[model samples]
Target: VDGNNVIRKIPCMQLLPIILFLIACLYQGERLDHRSCEALEVILKSLHFDFINLQATQLEENGASSLLDMILYYESTTHLDISDNSGMGTSGWRALAHLIKQSVCLSRLDVYNIPMVGYPALSLSKALLTSRLTVLHLHNAQLSGMPIYTLVAALKVNKALRELHLTNNQLNSYQDALQLGDLLQYNSTLKTLELSNNALADAGNMFVFTKLPLNICQSH
Candidate 1:
């Protein structure tokens, strides 16, 4: 569902308030150099149908905080994309955690290609552990690899999460790989797990060995 399209459908008489709100918030951060929040709020308000796309839009900590505020303020959202946001570093992930811990509505978050996420990966991991998520993607994002455990733990309890993607990440040490295998044994909700294009060696290969579906796992 395109909320933007629906927002366009409302009669001019009924949509004036929303328009005003958008104008007020869309660039609200321009002054403080942090307009992502107000703009995000506008986006949320516009989506009356289902699904919202915020993918790779360069949202920073300020915008992420605002998104979190709205999520908590409204008891969570269904879809969100935070990938490639140059501003969302360690601090931003922590802010997101605060909101995720409170509400379980966020089912998808794409934070790929973020160079500054290594330190904050733990914060995101913690959020996933306690919160409810269904889809998680962190492709090619810089990370300390600490969050992998949090991810492992979350996979066990995250009944809603069905897909996880961390392709090209640096999570391929022996211990980490083995730990992931252990976690997968208990993870019944996930249907797709992507750990490709990483530093997987023989140890890592053995971790997912026969467990991975033949369709998804190939080659040596």
Candidate 2:
């Protein structure tokens, strides 16, 4: 079938249309790009709310494009699970940044195993600047070096995030933990922090707890 006909069959599942379009294009051996994603964006306004779970499949750039469009254009979706999918790339991360820039309605973001580096890291950092995410999980996704620093900087200004899981992401140095500790000193909204199996020194771990806010509920 042609692209127009495939687009016509797209349902109200938000990003699902983009995935279908992508499949049709691939079956016909055509390249996919942002233009199709833009077309799918036109139908997003009709969706009231969404709780999509694309964790089972290997989400590729097309899926990321669609997801990013949903994040950028729609405000009704509250829960999105993109865990265990290693198909997203730099472009996808960049798209996610746009969503973060435009929306503050996302409460939970699970981006586990989607490795990000370079500009994409910068974009996610930018999202943290204004994102209303209450539970943010970036487990073992190579978020070291500058990305960690950027996240720490955003935490200083972010007031809505409650749970931050940086489990097993190679956060080994004491200074890194100290930097996070410094942010927690000023951030009272965050309650639980999971930093297990990292390279945290005993003293650094001690400092993190000492610097934690008085109202913290848990930190594992």
lDDT (CA) per prediction? 0.63, 0.69
**What pairs collide in candidate 1?**
29-34, 29-35, 118-143, 118-144, 134-161
**Residue 32, candidate 1: how far off, in angstroms?**
10
Model 1 alpha-carbon drift over 4 Å, by segment: 1-33, 39-43, 75-77, 89-91, 115-119, 143-145, 210-220
lDDT of 2 at 109: 78
Model 2: residues >4 Å from true position, as ranges?
A: 1-46
| Candidate of highest lDDT | 2
Candidate 2 per-residue lDDT over residues 1-220, each given as its tens digit? 4555555666647557666564455324233344544554544554544564445355467667675777556774676666676656766777677776667676787777766567766788888888878888888777766778877888888888899888878776566877778778878888888887677878778888788777776555
lDDT of 1 by residue, 1-220 (tens): 6556776788978887776565455433332135545545545554432344445555666666666677567653576655556676555677777766666567777766775345566676667676777778877774325566656766666666678887887777575676567666776667778778878787677767645554333332
TM-score of each: 0.70, 0.74
